[model samples]
Target: MEGRSQWGTRAGFVLAAIGSAVGLGNIWRFPAVAYENGGGAFFIPYLFALLTAGIPILIMEFTMGHKYRGSAPLTYRRMTKKAEGIGWWAVAVAFVIATYYSVIIAWAISYSYFSINLSWGEDTEGFLFGDYLHLADVPGQMGSLVPGVFFPLIIVWIIVLGVLIRGVKRGIEIANRIMIPTLVIVFLIVVIRAVTLPGALTGLDAFFKPDFTQILSPHVWVAAYGQIFFSLSIAFAIMITYSSYLPKKSDITNNAFITGFSNSGFELLAGIGVFAILGFMATSQGVGIDEVVAGGVGLAFVVFPAIINEFPAFNEFFGLLFFLSLVLAGLTSLISIVETFVAGVAEKFNISRTKSVLFGGGLAAILSIIFATQGGLYFLDAADYFINQFGVAALGLVEVILIAWILRKLGLFKNHANEISDIKLGSWWTISLAVITPIVLGWMMIDLLRLNIMRGFDTETGNYEGYSNMFIMWGGWAVAIGALVIGIVFSLIKWRSNTSAKEETEDISNVNN
Candidate 1:
């Protein structure tokens, strides 16, 4: 095999990790969840989850990646030898995620292009194609495909492919360098614009002013934990894949903290930026704060565009910056998704990097195209919930189980003790992974099931609304559970095979010697 390219520097790796962590989840989803759960009170649970759940899981992923020195599939196979089946599970989960994630990136690019053109204000109608095809109503048009959506989605995939074709150092690094900085600068500008908006303080107050009473609610706690997990890209194979390229001596614990904190801090800042601007808009337009804080596609497409239009002079410019930032954030994370598969292919087949990338990139593009035609936006949302939410949570459960129990049997942690920080994980990590975290995640799944049953039949439309909360919740978990089962079964089979092979190989070598 050719020499695998590692991250050129530690900072590069961190930037890439941060890029993955701080995407739509942070800027788009976090604020919405925070507002819906309990505004200022949501921060408490979010912070706690970050420290307890997010950081530990992140450290575990990073450590696994670095230790195995391979992609998710190969890494798990290598580490657990007998547990190669689990590696496949990670691969399957990652693949499902990458397929749909690209579509979202495509949407972000489409939005950014129009935002720069100021199309939202000049001809909002043109942004909508067929009667049901409105660029602004992504969640609403779940089951419908607009040519406008398909065309741009293809463009996004092609762009991602082009970057991957260039390889990690030249492609991934360059993209991160440009996208990460641009995202930060644009985010700052948006935040400043939002805070300065007349009467924007109302939104800021809503975000910052704590309603401590809400903290007592289990719903709030769940939201915080979900946000922390989702925001940091923990429980997914992305972090592990990204960390695979790290140098041996890098501090996994400190780096995990950096990634977690950087992500959460950005999320908090994003909440401030979004709510502040929304507050000003609400004050000016006599709209309720709830309207301004409406989530998912509503916040990104309809509400944000509407708010941008209010600033006639700078609408196009700021809109451009905002959407461009979204595109960059999405791209940064998208690369990692692509990399996970590419690395897997390379390791699995012992193929050349070039071949691996082409295979993975081609496959992803084809899958995305199919998705594009089939109500891409709707598929993207459903796939995201499935992969990012339940898929990741399940993976987290497996990882903790493997490390805390399975790896312990092999004494992997004993060797890793010196590499780990002085802050020992102890039984707490095991308890959380084996018991606490899984239970919490299970509860969220149940809650989601309930939410779905309630909303599945939309009385208003007399049809199943593509964007029904139930659909997102239930459909997401169904996909997640399916992926989890595949992963666990595959891991067990592969683990047995790998262990047998290793033992045979060792015995033969010993006999010959």
Candidate 2:
């Protein structure tokens, strides 16, 4: 068998890590979350979450991967055979995310072209639902595929899988090296243009105006932690897989800080750019900022198009740059998401990388095609909501509990990371994982469960997004829970590789054993 691949340089690994962290959510999600939570005052909880939950978890996962020198599943299997299923659960979440996530990038690709001529026109919302997506009247419709989305989706998979087949250092690293810098440059141009718009100051004021009263709210704190959690892409089987490629002497603690800070910095920039333009839109429409505020698909596909149409000058060029940024950001993230399962499949079955890319990437690509249909958006929305809440959040809670309490391995991981890191581990790191994160995440889960239950009872709206309860049960809840069932089944299968049960346990250092 071939030896594990290592990153060519520390810079390459950092770029890739940052690339995974910064994605579509940074552009659309963070700005709205910040505004809705506490405006400028949200930073208090946001910064706290980053330090306590985000960076601490990143350091732990980085240490685990670097020390074990294997993919997420393999790394957990090395820790203990009983925990291999948890690793596969993370991989399954990544797999589901990759499916709908690629379709979104395809939307950006189409929109980039649409930007060239201001093609979406005045009725941006109508154009998106009626013309572009051809959204079905109800959920689970699965009408014929939209060529606009399907074709570009094919291109997205081809590019992502092509990169994976090239191996880690040559493919993932090199792609991030180009995409991350280019994404920054393009986004900077967009931000500069956005801030110069006529009502830019109004938007900036609305964004930065501190609402200190909201700081005491539990919902505000939860929003901060949720944004940090989803934004940094932890517990998605990504950082673990990416960090597994690090060389022996790499600084896990510093790398976590760098990745965490870089991602938050971009989110700050995104807040500025998004709000600045939204301010311009409000001014043009002679309305308040609150009237135009939005996030997710509506912000990207609907509000942004309306804003681009109102641009005083260079509408086409500015629109193109904005959507192109989405494309670049989405591609970089999609590459990382796809690679998680790709690496998992390759190592689990002991198949060649090429075979793994074909088998895994091909399946995800095929599954993603459903999102290209009329009911695609409904399916996408439900799956994304349920998966993030149930899959990623639940998996994260389980991961921390298993490693911290069940396996009692935080001390081992802390010692391993400290030996090679410039910044040594402290009680804060241990306390955050064992205590702080679990408590907050538990609150988040319970809150989400309560909300969903209330929604289920609502007569007018049966479930999330007003979809039928049956649809949410199958499309949303099933997909979220199905990942765990699939993970356990995968774990139960015997390895086809030369790895023996004893070898899995013995391969780790004495510290781990």
Query: Top model by TM-score, which number?
Result: 2
Off by over 4 Å in 2: 459-461, 499-513
Clash number for each model:
9, 0
Q: Residue 68's C-alpha lDDT in candidate 1?
A: 68
lDDT of 1 by residue, 1-513 (tens): 567678888888889899888887787788888887778878778887887788877877787788767777766655545555566677777778777777766666777777775565534434433332443344424454556667777787777778877877787877888888889999999898888888789998877777788899998998888787677876656887888888877878778888889888888888999899889888988877876676666677667888888873687788888888888888888777777778776766667777877897788777776456535555565677657655666666666666655554223442463355555556655555556666777777778667756765645522235455555454455667777677666555422123223323122112212
Candidate 2 residue pairs in backbone clash: none
Each candidate structure's TM-score, on Cα atoms with residue i matched to residue i, is 0.85, 0.98
C-alpha lDDT of candidate 1 relative to the true structure: 0.71
Q: Give residue 171's error in model 2 in angstroms.
A: 0.5
Q: Give the RMSD in angstroms, all C-alphas superposed, for model 2.
A: 1.8
Displacement of residue 260 (Cα, Å) in model 1 is: 0.4
Error of 2 at 54 (Å): 0.3
User: What tens-digit string does per-residue lDDT give for candidate 2 at 1-513?
Assistant: 456788999999999999999999999999999999889999999999999999999999998889777778888888877778888999999999999999999999999999999999999999999999999987888999999999999999989999999999999999999999999999999999999999999999999999999999999999999999999989978999999899889899999999999999999999999999999988988999999999999999999999999898999999999999999999999999998998888888888888999999999999999899999999999899989999999988998988887777899899899999999999999999999999999999999988877976775766787877689888998999999999999999988776434354633234343
